[model samples]
Target: MRTVRFSAVAAVTAAALTAVTACTAKSDAEDGTAIQVTAADSTCETSTTTVPAGHVTLKIENKGSKATEVEIVFPDDRIVAEKENIGPGTKYRLTAEVKAGEYEIACRPGMKGHGVRQKLTVTGGTTVKRDPKLDKAVADYRAYVQEQADETLPRVETFAKAIKDGDLEAAKKAYAISRLGWERTEPVAESFGDIDPKVDVRADGLEPGQKWTGWHRLEKALWADKKIGAEEKTLADRLVTDLKDWQKRVGTAEITPTSMANGAKELLDEVATGKVTGEEDRYAHTDLVDFKGNVEGAQKAYELLKPVAAKNDPALAQELDRQFAALDKLLDTYRSDKTSYDFVSYDKVGKDDRKELSDAVNALAEPLSKLAAAVVK
Candidate 1:
């Protein structure tokens, strides 16, 4: 029984608090010695307990006095479970097994404020109940890839138009313009593990004469050292390849709508789990810093999720459409207001950041998540 001081984000009593929906339900366990982690500031309380490696039950109840959540992390660096704002006077549950190792437990009000933390000690356990939902996750991810293949062509055309029309600088900027978007999509790509070689495009890291798969390829072109060249042939080649593939349906030879939606879902999952990286080269952002990474992440979410619209169920489709509308507004506003993003300059973001626009981009993740759940189901 060691008590350690865990630094959690504190909530500002005077600050305005927005209503937050639960990100996921609480996990279950066998010990039943479930402890409730409560927020000293707000009357928010969450059910908690020790996680013994293997199968266990964790009942994270939102005492409903205020919005709250609990995050269960594992030694494997897996965010095994997360229970967010269960609602006042209401509760949500998730049943999951734990694995042996060091773990970090974080229970907070939302992404903004102070919460609670405890170390979960687990030796091991023998329970092998895997959720079938994960299988659907795989299928859902593939569908996302298809969606990207389906939609990126148009954007590629827009990009090509900018390039062919003598906007070489625009062309360079556009190369990795979608790198963040692609990075967001990569996690889902990883889960597929073995993509259909004939259908799924390979981004097998940069190699000689190898074509680029997603947005990062373009980013490479933009940042490459030119050897006395009038134009970046590599960057132009990728655009051409991408645009052509879009037209001819490369990698998407047999993609179903569900698979595409799943892929989009997987990308969003990466963002929530922080599995997504910000940028490859720190200096890469010299041209466009923080804004590009976030903006691209947001844009990729939108671009990759759109096609699945036609394939989603009625309810899911409607939600996706709604999210798209809001996100579109955010992107439009962001583009028009360059002052909002510090991409072109080293200016720090002010209190009135363009996060509204950025959040709009990130927000699509929710609907997309719903869409992914439905697609996988």
Candidate 2:
């Protein structure tokens, strides 16, 4: 058996680690005080339990044999800061604007199991007065996510029907189109337990005793094996059903400005780590299409938050605009005549072009990570 190294899977795992913090590590601690946090196989050690309530930078290092991730969760279970995909000896920095309150620090080693956690207490800082504008932005973003879900539910039905009909040719065409809606709303889909897996789980990560199902399973059957069986039809039906249920539930889901900003950064991280590697659409060679959808979704979140972010921190807002535009322009060159992106198989993508896309995404993500902090300032 061949040892398959799915770099894209590893990247997704890494991106999940720091879903809360997206900014690049600062060269100088000019804006915030730096605190050291170390992760090992059994322990998550912080330099201090208490921090001033304001801009706080967590400089997290993995001193473990396996990949590790650290996250700071609020009393309400909201993530305020995190960094993931820290290799055996790697380090990352995440800066967050914090309120004076109790928080929790958690560390997951090898990216499995419930993480070791410790209490984190913030002091000597006042929470900012609540802003109605920021609240409205959060509400609007949720509505947008709900709207995407509403649009995607029907498309999923179409894709599933093609598979159920055993029309491999039609299924192949519908597969990519169906993914656009899901990709645009992936961050929210992920919040619905089991829905994301049922609709989009890749081949790499299957829970123990869990049979692999969903779109990727069907993708392999259709594209790799060139056969569609009863099993494929069943999986397709479940996917459409799951998506329908997911869309109904997402309308009233709780979402915050912090989550919106993090979602945007998360989507860019998806592009940087997975789509760039072409490992995401390995079977279909449709990674470019997925990449465009992820970027479009991220861009929407940023645009929705632009008003409040600009009011609080004009510099951060302007930087995001420039980076978003730069990334979009580069992505545009890959468009197919009939679609937003030209379909280039992962194996056929040039290294230079891959690097270009990867670099552009990272440039956007760094500034994007700072938006939540800026808005709360």
Best-fitting candidate, measured by lDDT? 2
| Local accuracy of candidate 1 as per-residue lDDT tens digits, 1-377 | 00111223223342433222222233332332244444432433334334445544444565545555555554322345544434555554333334566665555553223344456665555434434443343355456556655555565556555555656566555444433333434433332222211112323422234334333333444445422133444444455574454434334332333334434444444333321232333224432332344334434443444444345456666766777666545444434364433243213323244345446546766666444334322
Report the alpha-carbon TM-score of model 2 versus the true structure.
Answer: 0.78
* Model 1, CA-based lDDT: 0.42
Question: lDDT of each model, Cα atoms only?
Answer: 0.42, 0.71
Which segments of model 1 are wrong by more than 4 Å? Answer: 1-170, 173-252, 267-322, 337-363, 373-377
Count of clashing pairs, candidate 2: 2
The clash count of every prediction, one per candidate, is: 34, 2
Candidate 1 to truth, TM: 0.35
RMSD of each: 14.1, 6.9
Which stretches of model 2 miss by more than 4 angstroms? 1-37, 46-59, 72-83, 88-105, 118-128, 337-342
- Candidate 2, residues 1-377, lDDT tens digits: the string is 00011222332343334423222233236546566778887777776676666666777888889887677776444446555566899887666666788887777776544465667777775743557877677787888887888887777788888888888898988887788877876766664334665667677755444577777888888889999888889888887777788888787554666667766777777777678987777788888888888989988888888888898899999999999889877877776554544565667779998998888988888888787667655
Compute the lDDT of residue 376 as modeled in candidate 1: 28
